[model samples]
Target: MNSIKQTCKNVKTLVDSFLNSTTPIFCTPTDEPKDTEAWYSTWEDNYIGDFLNNSVVKAGLKKIADFYCAKQLDVLLRHSSELKASSYPQLYRIYKECCKRLGFVKMPKLYITYQIFGINALSLEVKGHKLILLSRMATIRLNEKELRFILGHELGHHQQGNLVCHTVNGLLDTFNTSSEIFGPMISDTIEVPMKRWCRQSEFNADRAGYICCGDIDAVTNLFLKLGMESVCSAYNEYKELEDAHPHLQTRFTELKKIHKTIKVNR
Candidate 1:
């Protein structure tokens, strides 16, 4: 665990350095409205309202991604130190390729780890700067293409710039991580919406990932290896949403829809 913590600290340092040097597109404080009501009124019933509503969701997604990346980095440093030095050089390289292919000039940093608990695969941090985290164990379990897609998914969160989501997530962590006794009702109220937003944000990220990966098979196979198929089978057999991720069929369908739109525009 000491090694894991050390690795996490190093990754955090790297992320801080990169963020310090990089200027964010939307980090400026504008005279724009702060509340959802004002935003909706200003947008005049456009999709911007939905975008504002999604702020909290986006932030939460970032926190989750950051935590997952930290965990993955720890795991990678512990189990695959040599592979980290050898085979994993391509990890960030492929991610950069994917980003460039998708027209993202500033590729988000990819932090790797062995494992992460809870329902996180990857996440992005958008507080002042953008950082991404990936599970090393998850990456090792996946093929090159899938890994790239996963990283792209996290980058999507960074692009989304959802600080409200991150704040809620941070609050939840504070409640759980602390010794304070919070009631189930309050916890449930905060958690349910957060989970729903997380699922929705993932769909958006899937679109981003598909665009970056540029290969449907690579993205689909990554989901499959992440146990999507098993979850689908279980849901069919038992009638339930069994996994944290969106249903496999739904995710695939959405990706295809986005891919078609992107191709038409291109």
Candidate 2:
């Protein structure tokens, strides 16, 4: 019994260390864009990059990304449409407007998958495939400005080095089914730190979106809508108390402050 306990403890430590190591952010092959200098502070990227690039996390992510690719593939396949200037001219127009300022060295392939329902866009980078999934509901639900926020936000992840965090998250979820006994423990140890990182990383992405759209109201409205969706009976003010994002109020306040600083500096 003691040996088993020791073994468990050792395994947990190893997993924790693996998850905490930093992975390098994804970048283009040559003449990489340094746009993050404008949108995100180096400290912000360093803080989270330190944890996301961990060898274990990166390895696990490489292994599990295929699961998500397979699971959501049918829906993705249906769309079969990649948005570009030639193909989806109108939508591509909006994407380009946001892309240039956001400083993406290369654009990720955009997949517009129509499911009967679901409102979301996703950024996934794994094994050299970078993709953005724009769902049907997102197209229907968001207006031109809101869509700009969404596009910049996704690009923000790429630009600001936040996608590895998402990749690490995918690994945890993918393994939850098979490793029930150890999964929860591994999940808890990483959650708090990851939660903290994710929330901060979100702030980075939000700021990037603001820079792209140059509209505080559009960005604030985007988060406000999500916050209202997540609201229960009470509002939590503690920054660390929330899931991978700051509360709506916190975000609204912080973003306002950031905008003010930017205006002053400019």
**Candidate 2: lDDT over CA atoms?**
0.64
Best by lDDT: 2
**TM-score between candidate 1 and the true structure:** 0.55
- Relative to the unseen true structure, what is the C-alpha lDDT of residue 69 in candidate 2, on a scale of 0 to 100? 60
- Cα error, residue 109 of model 1, in Å, equals 2.3
> Model 2 clash pairs?
21-54, 22-50, 22-53, 22-54, 23-53
lDDT of each: 0.53, 0.64
Q: Which ten residues in a row have the lowest lDDT in candidate 2?
A: 39-48
Residues 21-59, candidate 1, lDDT per residue (tens digit)?
544325466785321111101113323224335433343
